[model samples]
Target: MSKRIAGPEIERLIQLLAKVPGLGPRSARRAALQLIKKKEQLLSPLAAAMAEAVDAVRICSNCGNVDTCDPCTVCTDPRRDGATIIVVEDVADLWALERAGAMNARYHVLGGTLSPLDGIGPDELNIKALIDRVAGGGVSELILAVNATVEGQTTAHYITDQLSGLEVRVTRLAHGVPVGGELDYLDEGTLSAALKSRTAF
Candidate 1:
């Protein structure tokens, strides 16, 4: 067993911090030390913020987005175009797209993609809700902004099949070389897609 270098409380803090994404045991130890050092400033505020979040955070009933409200701000926003919906794999993708502000449109979160190997299927995700929304009308276009993974593509295909008879136009994100990316570092698939999807320059 490893030697006890700190008190049980501090060790427990490091253990819990390690469970967070991108944080390893060593990183969590460093973070715990920093938090303890700035107990009055950073730690106190962070603790309060976390407590508030636990009380206020809610899962939106409409689009599956997490907010402090039921329908979420996006769903109730009259300024956004309800006719255009960007379907993403998760809330993270939704937030990323919102940050980009690519279009003044609405969004739908699938919760997760189809991963049969991982035992996640159609019913596991929020797909039925999406279909219901489309069937309810007013939605004209559906942009599948899912990742370029096999599971993501499978989920997109499944969603498309479900909406086959619907009136909505389904589109996928264009795969290509990123802005400022050199062609030498790009893979064959990206190069091919970029060439095929070449637009007016």
Candidate 2:
């Protein structure tokens, strides 16, 4: 009879699990214990799903969204307003905007924002692709929905500069106070933007 297995295999699994975001050694240990308790119900299915996703998931060539299909559902959907495209940083942000159910326009995922310090420039991102999409015509407005970080703002400004000569309307998300922040702790940028965007106040 073969001797029982322990130590190395469990340690390897825990180490690999710890590499995932928000999961440290403690959480990985707990998760491994749970998986051991219900291997058939959780571990097997989880492994299968991860394998399937690895094989099937791909970035959409048109908009940079991740999907099993090439164009992704949003790009393939006919009802979405193709003439109005919302430019975002990543697929997660795109999904967040979609979940809001307020934006009727299509999307262009930039993959990431411009961060010169990090050596991520326009060429590294999907800025050229976005410009090409605009140049192809039929697009009436391009909404800059990148995050409020410094890199995000820089990327947005770069995009705005690129489309300056193009015959399309460009807009940005109105920056302002958070719904829950105390008025005294607000930053200068937020206060200025909020004041500039104020209406009938």
Q: Tell me each candidate's TM-score.
A: 0.95, 0.91
lDDT of 1 by residue, 79-162 (tens): 999999999998999999999988899999999999988899999999999999999999999999999998899999999999
Q: Write the per-residue lDDT of candidate 2 for residues 130-172, one digit (tens) a residue.
A: 9999999999999999999988989999999998788899998
Best by lDDT: 1
lDDT of each: 0.94, 0.91
Candidate 2 Cα outliers beyond 4 Å, as residue runs: 1-5
The RMSD of every model to the true structure, in order and in angstroms, is: 1.3, 3.4
lDDT for residue 10 in candidate 1, whole number 0-100: 88
Model 1 clash pairs are none
The TM-score, computed over Cα atoms with residue i paired to residue i, of candidate 2 is 0.91
